[model samples]
Target: MNAIAFTDVSRSYGNVLAVDGLNLTVETGRTVALLGPNGAGKSTSINMLLGLIRPSGGRIELFGRPPEQAVARGEVGAMLQDGELIPELTVRELVDFVRGLYPEPLDLDAILQMADLTDLAGRRAGKLSGGQSQRVRFALAVAGAPRLLVLDEPTAAMDVESRQRFWAAMRDYAAGGRTVLFATHYLEEADENSDRVIVVARGRVVADGTAAQIKAKAGGHAVRFTLDGQSAAGLDALPGVSAVEVTGGTATLRTADPDATVAALYRGTSLEIRDLRLAGADLEDAFLALTREP
Candidate 1:
């Protein structure tokens, strides 16, 4: 069974639509990324999945049941952007507090270790730094041994070393046939960690595919050249060049065919090429191109 599914889901706040026509399917044992800029409804979608908000239209299913039902079964875990952690509670105390809510919970030590909070177990939540607070939230999320982990900017805390450790823990969790839905502003994290990538813009899904497939959807490769003292002509005007940007005698061409673009760039100009190289397309490129302001 799919871990979670949303069919044409939409959420509105009065006259404002936060999420619109969102359709998603996430399977067990895989990590799915929900990526978008601010006001893209990434948080709203996650809130709906967590049973914290209601969709205004369409349907949502979690583990063959509604979100609320799945949540009631205590199989869902969440670490939201804003949490209400008790100030006086230490990491150990907070873990114990969340653990008590579940009938069967994972070991406290294991959770703390996985979240790199073992050393901070005695530190109070209010005293912990931003990164440290995030780790404590992660510890609580995993305390119940959830079958579905929903983390929003889960690794916004933690140094590089701790982030990798946390990622390994997530990989192990998914390998055990659990599901994870991750939302973050960190593009590199989504590109590196997810099995599938979902891009949301204006509260709608504009792209959904693997890392390579999504890049391919944007277009083929391009050729970029830096000119010395003349304007770049013919290259930007090529038939296959989809988009072009020129500044300070430097031009970047987004082309549908790389070879054609390269051949055309040097066909008519002796612009004193300082550097000429093929730019490989990737998620960041696609995102910037697709979401360009009209």
Candidate 2:
């Protein structure tokens, strides 16, 4: 069965539409990333899946059941961006409290080790730093031994090292055949960790596929080179070159065919090019290009 499914789902607040006719499905054991700029309805969609809010139109199903029913059975665990840890409770205490709410929770020691919180188990929740608190939240999310884990900006306040460790733990968790759906602005996170990426723009999904497929939606390859005193005025007119930008001695070209563009450049230009480089679009580049206002 699919882990999650949304059929023509939409949500609105008064005159503002947050999610518009979103149709998506996530198979069991898949790690998917929901990527979008601010106000792109990522949070709205997540909220609906969590049963925190009702969709204005269409339907949503979690593991072939209503979202609320699945959640009630401890099938889903979520770490939202805005919740706060209760004050005065120690890290271990907070985790224990949440674990008790579920029928079958993970072992306390294992949870602590997985979240890298064994050292801070006795630390007061309110006394922890932002990154540390985030880790505690992660621990709580997994305490229920849920089938579906949902994280919204899970590494927002974490440092580089913390982010890496957190993802490692997440990878381990998902390796057990659990489904993971995370919404993140970090393109590298989506690129490196997620098996699939769904790009939403203006309350709708614009692209959905593997990381490479999403990047391909933006265009082909980017060719960059530095050539002193060389003009790029005619480069844009080259076959396979879609756009060209020249700044001082540096020229950047967006090309549908990198080999053809490179051959045309060599055949037409005599100026010696320095620092020439060819690279395909990464998630960030594709995101900006695809979501740019037209």
Candidate 3:
């Protein structure tokens, strides 16, 4: 069964369309990364999927049921960007409280261990640091042993170590054949952690595939070499070159057809091409190319 489905989904606020005719699906047990620029409707899409707000148009389903019904049954777990914990409650208290709401909650001790809250289990929510608070939120989200987990910017306040631990925990949870869908600005995280990535722009999907496939889709390859006291002019005019950059004595040309670009470079440029290299585009390069406004 599919974990999520969105068909012709859209959301608008007054004159602005936050999500426009979005169509997507995720099968059971797959980890998907949802990526977009600011105001690209990632949060709006998540809100509607969680039933926090109604979609302005179209249909959505969660595990073959309506989102509200699935949520009511404790089948969906979410850690959003802005949810706040009860200030008066200790970490343990809060986690336990949320666990009691689910039909088959994970063991309290297990939840603490997974979220790495064992040491701070008794700390009051108000006394915790920003990163600590984020961990607490993760604990709450997983307390129910939910089948589908949704996280938005889950590691925003976390340090490097905390982020690593968080992804480990997430991977452990996902290893249980559960589905995970996360939205994060950390493109590296999406590249390293997810099975698939979906990039949105102007409130609609612009790219969807594995990281390698997406990178290939966005000007697939790069040709680089050292320029020995030679002009960098006319590099952009080369066949299949989308962009050209020169830093120090090195020139890098991004191209959809590296073969053509390299042939033209050898035939056209009088510059000495030293230490030449050809490689696939990285995720960051692909992201900038795809999201850059025309």
Candidate 4:
């Protein structure tokens, strides 16, 4: 059974639609990454799942129950962006305070060590840096050792080292039959860490699949060639070519029909093709293509 499921969910404020009809599912024990630009309804979608706000339409279920039911049962761990932690309490104290709310919670010391906060145990949560504050929230999120973990922009403010540590800790935690749902705009993080990625744009799911699958769907085939005397106008007339971007001596032709484009290009130009290469599709390339205007 899916850990989280949304079917035709939509949220609107006045005349502005934040989340359009959307369907998504996160299986138990898989880390599903949600990718989108700013104000793309990522937060609104998450808010519905977290029970912070009611959806304007459609239905959502978590662990086969409604959002409030799942949350009321203490089966969820969520760390939304900018959620405040007590400013005066030390890291240790904050973790302890959050831990006291759960019946069978994880050990505070273990969580601290896993989060690499042992060194900063004495540091006040309020005085900590942005990265440090995020870490504190992460510690609290896992303190209950819940079944489902939800994180929004978890490593946005983290440094290289801290981001690596956080990913490792997250992997360890999710390995224990726990599901993870993360929303972020970081392409590398989504590509490298997520088991699956659901991309949202304009309040709708633009793409959904594994990193490679989604990239492939976004059309990764690029034909790189150099034309001796063929002008930019001639290149744009090529059959099956979607776009022609030229710089220096190279022209990168992005096309869905690579064979047709290559045939047309050869017919149009006599320039010796030097270093003609096909660039494989990558997540970043795919994301840009998907989010780009059609």
Give the alpha-carbon lDDT of every model. 0.81, 0.90, 0.91, 0.85
Candidates sorted by lDDT, best first = 3, 2, 4, 1
lDDT (10s digit) by residue, model 3, range 1-294: 999999999999999999999999999999999987678899999999999999999999999999999999999999999988999999999999999999999999999999999999999999999999999999999999999999998999999999999999999999999999999766678878899999887778888999766666677588999986789999999998888898988898989778788898989877678899998666566667788777
Give one digit per residue, the lDDT tens place, for model 1 in 144-217: 98899999878876789778877887887677778999997666677778988888888888888885565555
TM-score of each: 0.80, 0.88, 0.85, 0.81
Please give me the total number of clashing residue pairs in predicted model 2: 0
Clashing residue pair totals per candidate (backbone < 3 A): 0, 0, 0, 0
Location of the lowest summed lDDT over 10 successive residues in candidate 4? 278-287
lDDT of 3: 0.91
lDDT of 2 at 140: 93
lDDT of 2 by residue, 11-120 (tens): 99999999999999999999999998889899999999999999999999999999999999999999998889997999999999999999999999999999999999
Model 2 scores a C-alpha lDDT of 0.90
The regions of model 2 sitting more than 4 angstroms off are 228-240, 255-285, 292-294
Q: Distance from true position, residue 144, model 1, in Å?
A: 0.6
Worst 10 residues of 2 by lDDT: 212-221
Model 3 segments more than 4 A misplaced: 220-241, 255-288, 292-294
Error of 1 at 166 (Å): 3.3
Model 1, residue 106: distance off in Å is 1.2
